[model samples]
Target: MLFAIVSITMLSCGTSRNLDIERGTGYNFQAGHPEYRTTVFGYMDEEEGTLLEIGAKIVKGSLIYKDEDDTLQARISVEYQVQDLDNNNNVIISEQSTEIIKSTDQDISSTRETLDLNYTHPIDPGRYEVVVNVTDLNTNKNITQSIETAIPETQKGEYSLSNVLLDGKIVGEGGWEPISTYDVKSKVDSLRFVFQVISPQTDKRMEINTRLLRYASDTSYTRPMHYSNYSPSSIEYKGLDYDEETELQSNRRVLTDYASTFIEFKFANQERGNYRFEVRAQRDGDEEELFKARDFGVKSKNYPAVRSARELARPLVYLMGEDDHEELMKISNNDSLKKEVDRFWLKNVGNANEARHVIEMYYERVEEANKQFSNFKEGWKTDLGMIYVLFGRPWYTRSHLKELVWFYSYNHSDPEYSYYFNQPKLKNKFFPFYHYLLRRNNYYYTVQYMQRQLWLTGQILTRQI
Candidate 1:
């Protein structure tokens, strides 16, 4: 089912985009980059002309940018879209955010131009559309073009994984931001978490921590050829009384009471390439053991650098307090609550009228919390829920602290932050004990103002909260 080639075509042309573009009914332009003399397609561009089992590939390669910004007096903007015309109802997936940019040498900021043009689509041999509409300073109107092509199917009973590269990262720091998985099969216990030291809250030169947890899982397992592999011995199965409605759990027993063996690894203090994570799996019996690896990188170069521990602890917002869950229920009923919620989503969309990231983030968070929260409670309605929804799940959490003290740490690489919290363990401890702290440099924000009351932000002492 995975053997599908994606056809591409220019979608629109307008004053919104500036450029000179051409896309014929069928791809006729010379393929590949002349300067590099590389092959037209990254892979062998095989477009089988079959409808039921046909795949087509297109390699537009790099955008040929002849910067005339100096004197040509030509300002251009371009927007593109490609569609599959074969099966009207079949879902056609195409890359939409690819772009090319040109700027003066001195304008070499992080906002400089980027070119991402490799596209793939599944379709039949027919008149597909490749639309690229461009606008220029000379005229206000934009031009649209289309291309048609046919694809020959691959040989019977065959497929390819030569160019397949599976890459992603942890939840915090927002790697693969809009991506989430409820399929237990897709879940990997230990992933190589990667991100830059851009957050003022993270230690730029800090070391990474690694932990291998003990679990009750079945020994037999199944995983993807490239994504992850199964270790029959390492997997402990959970009881059926628990609910795990994931697609991958169909034929296997579930796992519960999972915990990790705490371990930390140190990396050099130099900045260079993106971080790489590799997980080694041991096989039971005579199965061949193998290694799995993934890549993780951050998109926001100007990401807020992690704050110093002193800077993070400078101000204590609440000296002593209690988490009033009752306050949360009451505030949830606020008349203007919907307005605040709407604004939250609007900010993420960056476009209120056409915003979807808010909805996207909601589902993504819900799925992640459910999959992760079942360890002790339902994720959707716990303190973890309250926190994860706002900040995010910590990269590392430990139960070694007292029954009342639950430690949630993010980016263990940084040795500075000791982000642990003391919660309601003994229900009758005190009336107004410290719950949590949200610390800033000599300034603090109170979650108390939030509709739902959760915990105190930063409390390092028993004398306080």
Candidate 2:
């Protein structure tokens, strides 16, 4: 199981605040061969007034493929139900499910793929609960996750802004790839934000000031800073002061014979953490008034506390390389350790929070190994402990009378290999503990691949199962 999302779009409302806010519950489940893991991420949004939008992003390569009409097919279904929270007695606003099936003309090699889904329904502005169900049709296994979201009452008689949307890849006109979860990982295509501005008048130009701020918990990143993710040929947003040549990152056009417009901005290569986007609108030559402000998060709950710079170095032992590990182990003071740890992850991972995410998750696996396999020494110091710490939870595990087998996905193109371990001495104090016998060819490649894959989504990525 894994999490996937990478896009940002803006939305706003006029007199009333349009918070397309939805909390992600990090829910996931699977069915079928345990080795074949599939995970789903999704969320709900209120697009134009009363227009509800639900989106999901799925990442998996272990789908069951079967021959169908001379072609191998993999099919999955997604079901969603939106109910009025105020009245739960079967007062359903919308309910339906869609099947997403991918097939190949030949035997599937690796089903590794990324797919997106969007569902829309009309409902009045109010509170609602959305339940999403994902099922692997081939295996008949499924999981459900639910969230609460609302569409505020529309405001009139004042300049209004639409809801802010966090979107992924843009496909076509009015097509936005919904960012199913705020828990973002990896450098993706681009973060796109879309906003709509409406005023009572017509053909009137407005100056929209936009600011982006990065935050760590309650602390702000030393005021707002501007960065561009656009190509050199694209127009950039500097400060205020506009000429015809100056184009703010906005969609300025006439709509419904009134002054209605949508502002959009795209950013690239941002690290994980909380972010705030501030948009202010003003009539030409008038004082700028704050139109809409909201805070968005690009982080996972997995490493919530490590965002602080002071407590940084504590997890270094679990993630550092051999030479770096030796040097870090020699640090005698907490102050110096924090400095070294901060420097290491910042330089290597390019973001302090990203570095903490990597360290926390790796050490999390290490601690799990300790609790599950402790013996003469700490579990992390034992062979079985080492494998668990580095390779993470095995996709498949089988235990026999005196032996255990762990299978891990190495090359997606080929079947995964197995790690065989057995208890050599039944009388030993650690009675049932098994030891890895280097009897098979060296598993260095498998270990390397496993660790790298973990880091791929761990360093700047989201939670995985």
Candidate 3:
């Protein structure tokens, strides 16, 4: 019998401190395909509290376009809400808007064309929960996401820095256009960072320092353990180390006090890797300093699609034995690595056609994992990524106060098909904000091994029967 993959409902619990974030689901072979993408940015405005910016990008292919008056049209509805975290999650601000996109050419609907949206709101400085809801009017499909953010207070005569904004445009092209995905595509030659510096004194020199750090390696999942709920007392964060440090601007004098000044920095020729961009501000004769950082990744030209031999070999760790994975990693030559990969699949599956099918399905999951769970490190290397690539998407997902649970079977009472991942609260700067550690236990060993054997023996040919 072939393995059957089914649709599952993801349950999220709402709370002030621990806001539940949800991703859209689909009936396709891949899992958690959010219909649209939304990005939120908060910047401090000297006169008008905080400037909240929201950008939502929707692919035309994902929506249902209708024929109206011989023109293809797609309608989208977006709602924004801001809740005060300090006030029992009370809704303080809300807005709703609808957009209708009309296209005369029907071919645009089949292509990967996108509808870009931009919204800006001024809010007070405080801790709040921001929620964005997007709906495709044609299909009535909706996706919602909530995030908890804190806006720092900047008073008069106080030196402070606004939130850093990232844009893909090179210098002197046009105005500031924020890159919503944060994932810098290979086509972008240079990255532009913009921020405002609120100065207290006029004609005073302020030093701005910028540092870039690349993700090194993660050894957290080197050994698989039995499933359990025992939380670690102290979790040592791994991956993301200091790669390069540089001062972008030094001793720059501001001409005005009690006003906001824009500071711009541009960097070119970034390598393909996960990175953390940090900025620090300090004024002469001031003992206090301000700092901010953001996480972004420089993806390969054909990202989410694993084409390189090295990239293809890395995800094989989930299926290969420890010694075998180590041996494959030792092969530095690209040509030899590709040959070994082809040999490994054929040796286990016993045929080229079946092996090809298995390889295609396996890498497809890897690509989807990268799209869903990537932050600082590639998604396939993350704990959740590893489980996704191994067992496929869970049958059901439920979120708790601080933990996320995934069930492989419809029967929630069965512990045998359940997996638990804990989100530990860490004070370290190196760790990403949304990192989750898998609660490894011996229970997973047998099931995961059985699944891996199914792939190797060519027992599982497709995602579903």
Candidate 4:
């Protein structure tokens, strides 16, 4: 049965499980693929709040063959979480499975647990304790028992159908950790997609679906498509399988908001050079395609994955802050973004915690947008709000000046703002303010805002008052 979400729903943490069945390590592989191994990361049990939320990023590494290593590799979940597990084993649990979010931002750590898992139940964290159970689907025997962890666990990102190397170049960088790169035919329009299929080294002939796709040239770089196979720019991933049984990446959907799901990425100046990448979803199990091989790396910098844009806004089991973002995207790339984001703020607040006035002020501007320009769109997306956010407030006496002139003094710690008007026959020579005025990424403030600043500093260029 298809578990398609008909609409958007945000399941806040400490809530109820949205699905019917909630047990299984969420190992990524064909339902009955023999070689696939299932591994669980951490265990937890609580007896306090009626809500027990277990959240972390996760990933499915290649299927593990028993006896190859001595690491714990199985996860077990109860069917009716938040509810009391019957003292008698009478609760009928359904077969459990998992899906992988294809187009996820890679994490800084190179591990299989890139995605996070969160479970909120009617049962409080202080109620019945959780016991970890394990069973090898291959051996059909209880192999181990795990103790529930009391504290929250951090998760790594996951990857899917991203292992295959087109001509040895990875088209998709799977899971946040261990970023395996791929090569493509073109750098200009190299479309990237994260598919549901397993690694090419698997014997499972099942076709996996795609969840999202991104265009390298797009402003945000990521395009959201919950789950659909049809596409004008779709590509199929297929290759040789090593017939290994390893747990796959996690594809949990605690919420479905695009802004809440996607991560914001910056180009990490890398030694291996730059390659634009994007992700797209697949149609279904029956759809197929043929791709040619290509080389992806000549001499590249070694960079790993990190958190997505959404994770930064709302933290999971752990609160990842601005400093965390700095480390995650810091990749094997450059240091520009990190320094710039900091300098942008440091110019005003030498110390943030001791001075939170600006942080409060920035959001106030956002709230203004929410109210004033909320017609058919949001204020953040409006021309006025964009400028407001970029430049605090405009200067001088003109809201719509015929022509605006801005000046900056980099060395002397001085900046200036001015406006000029020269219209011979027009009553309003002003070019309808906010016309094509888009936020130019990072800026100190607007012309009017600078004017206000100068007025406060007593550096009015064209005024004596």
Candidate 5:
């Protein structure tokens, strides 16, 4: 059972439009369109309502460097707006700032070096939407994304927990830095979570319990096409198989109203999967408990690269016939599976060199899909991930009120090359709000088949602006 039935609604296609990078509304935020990564954290502040922190990490290679007085430099602009969700999405706070990155080495942009930018703000307790916009000043290209956060109202005597923060110490790093992407890199052996426990009574003994659970399955498709005819239903929230648990007792002495503590969980040799980390706190004499949870993914050491035979075979649902894909997936032996996958590609392209090229290009799209569209399940398993892996990046992307549209051709008036996805009204705690459902139609069947034929014949399809 590699494929599961997905029910999705068929909506009328929308008008084709190009992304407006300057305005920041039409870009695909979840698809890594901004060429940067961002992470947000919220903390409880006694005086200020909530301390909101945004961390943006930009890879030097993604920036356009200009030579200035024998030195290479790049400039970036970051702007953010906080909107009150309860008040008709009114913008309550907005600010913009810029940073200049300089390098003496000319080849700096070719390396994996990165610049870290941090922003902090205080806001009242409420449900709010935070939109962060980042632009490469030299290129004038930008990306904008929005995330929903809730700040709990604090009471004097009630016990509460602040938002959990995930951090990791890289192999060479001296101190722990925030793992803002929530995807733990292969270089990290253990995960560190930091948060504050607020209690009313001084010198109170408390018990803290932590549990880690791993998802039971990965997002693999059994079907050929990504769209469905029925109304979309949420992905079933599979039970998280219990993996590990730990308990710590707080020493009965408190210097202030709240105590900050961090717990480390080792993930060395752990299977690759999505995991949930939960914490529960209760005072020794009281039954009331404070709890918090966060979800994250563990990437293979050679991340974004499909190394295993099973990983290589799964994405073939897009390229192989249903019967062929099913047979490939049925191979139980890893060695045999690897050989068969090699033979399939070699057979399709008719030569060893072309086979190698096609395999690399195909999986590269699969890897990019994983990085861009992953949610509760892997990105390639999602609707957007499927389209991305098959068709490559859309020539134009636009985000409407609750819908996301992508166009493959430069002709904005033609609906034939446009695809539409709508965000469902249903909500899931384990899923991000940005998840969208593809609008299926009979017309897509013809297009999907044509794309599959193009790939099988060793032809790469891409949109030229």
Candidate 6:
């Protein structure tokens, strides 16, 4: 199966003494100056039980450089691992890379380095997790991301489609660089999607139908309280089928056996946000035999500033009680909402500085979510956003092909609390949104505690006072 997982951690700590420095653990935001940010993209082949290809992009501007013989260079140490949670067997990989940056006459410049890391491991088929860690050795800045994946047993002599690969302007030159997540400023006019079909059933004709749509998080239609629809006509691609005799079928490209072929897509003034691309392989009139999807975001160069108090307080909706929530909804204006917000926090936390600290911490997380977790809509509205706003950073996280597991605990030795989120289709269209099964009684307590401690970091607030 094709898997594209982009992992991020939003955590906080109380004091320097309480810092728990794990190889793959770090805060989503820092009170200090900005630091280097890394973006990762990848897919795992479960059938092979090994094919894992990951692509990473590090923006040069985000890094801090040191002077070395008139040359400015930044050194970073990277550690990545894939673990079988069931067996506790993991393959840990680490490396170091240096990027030499050139000083420009101007104060700032745009320079980035892209890395491709590929690995293969043979193991029993089951649930597995992968983690990626990057640290700036110069400043000891660390960032970690992880995901959970499912690898199916590889079948022999079967016609199968490879995972969709995101490419630069060139076709096969950029070896399977998956675009797991991205922003609008990084958008290019021409991009290629490459994959392969192995051991085709030549006797039966097949057609690959592909559709692209932007997610719409506001419009609700289903039982799932958080579920939303996608915007139509924003981004659409209809795949065409061709027979060997015809050579070409309309605008669609024909599938070849064993070799990698690509479909070149052109962009026309697209919006910045999250988009979903789904490809289905089936006989002309038959149901879809193979279903696969890839979710990517068109990020803006800079996030819009949170202007009003209501905007800042919007993230707190998850922490409100039914009565407070009702009162909040009744307020029709941001000015009034601002007063209500101040009173709400002031009531819970009497000290003004302490209340400011709490409000700042919560909104900082909300801003980070908007930067990293945005999909079809704002990041705070997605399922991940809901959990992050309510529960803060997960103690630890696991990545899978179709599911993401988050673990939480008061301390490392305590019984770990877990949350399971999976990718499910709405109206047969695939999206990257994962729905958390927060139905457990324990989770309610966790939520309540997180809400109670909105002003505190690295600790839960059991009661408002």
* Winner by lDDT: 3
Q: How good is model 5 by TM-score?
A: 0.62
After superposition on all CA atoms, what RMSD does each candidate show versus the true structure?
23.8, 18.5, 9.8, 22.1, 10.5, 13.9
Question: What value of lDDT does candidate 1 attain over all alpha carbons?
Answer: 0.27
Candidate 4 Cα misplacement greater than 4 A, ranges: 1-205, 208-213, 216-385, 390-465
Which stretches of model 1 miss by more than 4 angstroms?
1-248, 252-321, 329-465
Best by TM-score: 3
TM-scores of the models, in the order given: 0.19, 0.46, 0.64, 0.21, 0.62, 0.46
Q: Order the candidate numbers by lDDT, best to worst.
A: 3, 5, 2, 6, 1, 4
User: Which is the better candidate, 5 or 6, if ranked by TM-score?
Assistant: 5
- Put down candidate 5 lDDT per residue, 1-465, tens digits, no spaces: 011000010111111111000001111433323456655556654455457666667767667889999889888899988788889999988989998989898777655556777777776666667787888888778887676666556566565655456667766767776665645556576566555565554456667776666655343452334445433332322212223323222222223334444334444434566666666677767876666555666665544447788889888888877888888999999999999989888887786876787788788788777667765456676778888888889988998776889899888666656878776643332233346567776777778888877677777633221
Question: Could you tell me how far off, in angstroms, the CA of residue 40 lies in candidate 4 after the best superposition?
Answer: 17
* Model 4 per-residue lDDT tens digits across residues 32-102: 22112222122222333223333333333322223314433433221222222334433322223343233
Model 1 backbone overlap count: 63
- Candidate 4 at 421: error in angstroms? 24
Considering only N, C-alpha and C atoms within 3 Å, which residue pairs clash in candidate 3? 225-441, 226-440, 226-441, 226-442, 227-441, 227-442
lDDT of 3 at 14: 28
Better of 1 and 2 by TM-score: 2
After superposing candidate 2 on the true structure, give the runs of residues whose Cα lies further than 4 Å from its correct spot.
1-50, 60-62, 68-70, 88-90, 98-100, 105-112, 168-178, 184-186, 200-209, 217-258, 271-274, 280-465
